[model samples]
Target chain A: MRDGKDDAAPRARRRFLKLAGLGTAASGAALLAGSGAAKAAAPAATEAAKGYRVTDHVRRVYDLARF
Target chain B: MIAPEDQGRAYLYRLLARLLAAAPDAATLGLLRGLGGDGSPVGGDLQGLAGAAATAGPGALEREYHDLFIGVGRGELVPFGSWYLAGFLHEKPLAHLRRDLGTLGLGRTAGTKEPEDHVASLCEAMALLIEGKGDLGAQKAFFERHLEGWAPAFFADLERARAARFYAAVGRLGARLMTLERDGFAFVEGVAA
Candidate 1:
């Protein structure tokens, strides 16, 4: 009575939940670590709100442009 | 790994984009007025921003934005790369930019009427590229292809526009930032050579 298709859904769900839990734990630990984590995330959080990536190309561009 | 200075640079680009995207509301003006500055010319421009915000009479900022960027016919400034590069709006430059945007997996925000080559939009794109984990070579190529062609002249025009008051300060800030970027890029190119 075991179906691989049925098993796959639950397995994926379980894996997703596990990863979510790990992310929450990591953020909780980050909060406990200090203000540095929050400061570091500020720009990223703002960028995420705007809904796009400036990407690593900007860094390379900046590096290339440097005198 | 992202460098902290690069992060700051990206933030500045986004800030400039937003400021140029629309007329600042009272809340936005308040925020600008509260911003502290260093002793640089850019810093002085920020101080000028605060002064302009403080003096923004009712409907003045909106009228200014309209006159400068969105008049009944055409605004004082075109703010589009195509116009600057190919002597017209919606030309080959814009088509090339669209292709580049597609390659970069970027697109205009939904319902936006302006072309992809608007200066504000371009600044936002640059900021997104910097923040989004894109490769350095792509960034350089994009800048050389799109921005390096005409942005500095645009800012200089902005600095002298008769309609410019608050925007003159913005022009100054933009010019300073552009210079810094140009120098930085030139230095890197020199080193590579």
Candidate 2:
């Protein structure tokens, strides 16, 4: 009851605002790191299918190699 | 030896046309895995060496085609059985093809006269065979006599051609198809075993 006075109300509000600001900053930093990881992932993906063109032929069941 | 039981191989031809017209399967990832997949190889190593030059990557295959068919100088592989069989480009095989064409009611396109032994023509013939478009028995006989012997030689050369990467695959497909057809025909000759 002693601390729950007029000053306590304002202090709690200030703490909540400060915590909200910190949470946003932490989330933004995590998002930026995630975005960087995704960006790095893209080039690696491109290298896997290097120079492979799409196969337009209809699907064939026979394994030509199985001949 | 190609086999009659090995029917409906138009899928192979269709795959080739697509690979040539567009590009190889993305599944393959541009790897030149071996293609002339007969049950056994008669002379695969030498053939692969000779045709390795015609790999269809950039300009190598086209240049090889030019040298083989359209080059200012004579080409290495003639791409025709008649040329190899009769020592000339056009010969009885082609004439017979026309006669058989009449019997089958199949007609040549307007001005496309590279002779019936041309690889494309051979491919077209094989497609027709697979689909039973022509008189199947006569066509089968013609294929056995005319194509069975020399087409393998041509495809072997093509597989190992200097420009043969992509085309090596094509050659492999062709050679494998020839083997299937040859065996199929042989089986019929034997007793449908």
Candidate 3:
């Protein structure tokens, strides 16, 4: 029962995001690049680390938060 | 096939995770001070955060963070999902989340004392999901299960917490993002249905 609505959902979501001031070039660049403080939470290393994985990003966040 | 909007979303989550994880260092604060926003509600919150960042120092922020999240006994607010959802820490909700995380190939990092349900950890998990570790369906499910039940209330509480100053802005931004995320996920479900 896929319809035009299905095709339109993502586009509509994007428009809603744009109207909310997200997806802008400047803001996105500032957040993604300029705010280099927080590293991207990648699943690669965590997945490979141990059968039990702790995400490096999460670990680093903890390390930084430590007083 | 991650979209630009999604990247922005992931970064926002990452930013929140970082701030909630700990007070920002001077370098992070400088970066925050340079941020700009538009007329949208999220934009306004970003502006508020920028203003707070501009005025705040690391030592003060660290103290404020401690008062708000890590007091001598317990902070003004406990930022754990289990605490919010079950009225205690290390409850069934956490157990459920741990099972889900295992399914997703994620786990608590060794040596970390905080439960996996801590707000920062959850935000980081969401960021990872958005970055491609999980698809839209998975993201929606995880968010609804873990965050939707109580995160908004937690943010509202954080905004009003006595120790909140810089974090008040964070609370506002978090509350706003949670609303947007809920709506966004609903949009996906509406289309899928």
Interface C-alpha RMSD after superposing true interface residues, each candidate, one decimal: 17.9, 30.5, 7.1
Question: In candidate 3, which residue pairs get closer than 3 Å at backbone N, Cα or C atoms, i.e. clash?
Answer: none
lDDT ranking, best first: 3, 1, 2
Best-fitting candidate, measured by TM-score? Answer: 3
**Where is model 3 more than 4 Å wrong at Cα?**
A1-6, A25-67, B190-193
Q: Which candidate gets the maximum lDDT versus the true structure?
A: 3
Off by over 4 Å in 1: A1-67, B110-113, B190-193
Candidate 3 per-residue lDDT, tens place, B1-193, comes to: 6666777777677677778877778888887887787777667888888899999999999889878877755568878888789876668999999998888877866565557887877887887787667877788888998999999999999999999999999999889878888888766763221
What is the RMSD of candidate 1? 15.4
The reply for model 2, stretches above 4 Å from the true place, is A1-67, B1-8, B14-60, B134-139, B189-193
Weakest ten-residue segment in model 3 chain B by summed lDDT? B184-193
Error of 1 at B41 (Å): 4.0
Winner on lDDT between 2 and 3 is 3
Per-residue lDDT, model 1, residue B115, is 65
Question: How high is the lDDT of residue A32 in model 1?
Answer: 18
Question: What's the CA RMSD of model 3 in angstroms?
Answer: 5.8
lDDT of 2 by residue, A1-67 (tens): 1113354542453244233222222122222111235335322322221112111111110111122
Largest DockQ belongs to which candidate?
A: 3
Two-way DockQ contest, 1 vs 3, winner: 3
| lDDT score at residue B180, model 3, on the 0-100 scale | 82
Estimate, for each residue in A1-67, the C-alpha lDDT of model 3 and write its tens digit.
1213346777787778767766763254245232344343254322222212223323433543453
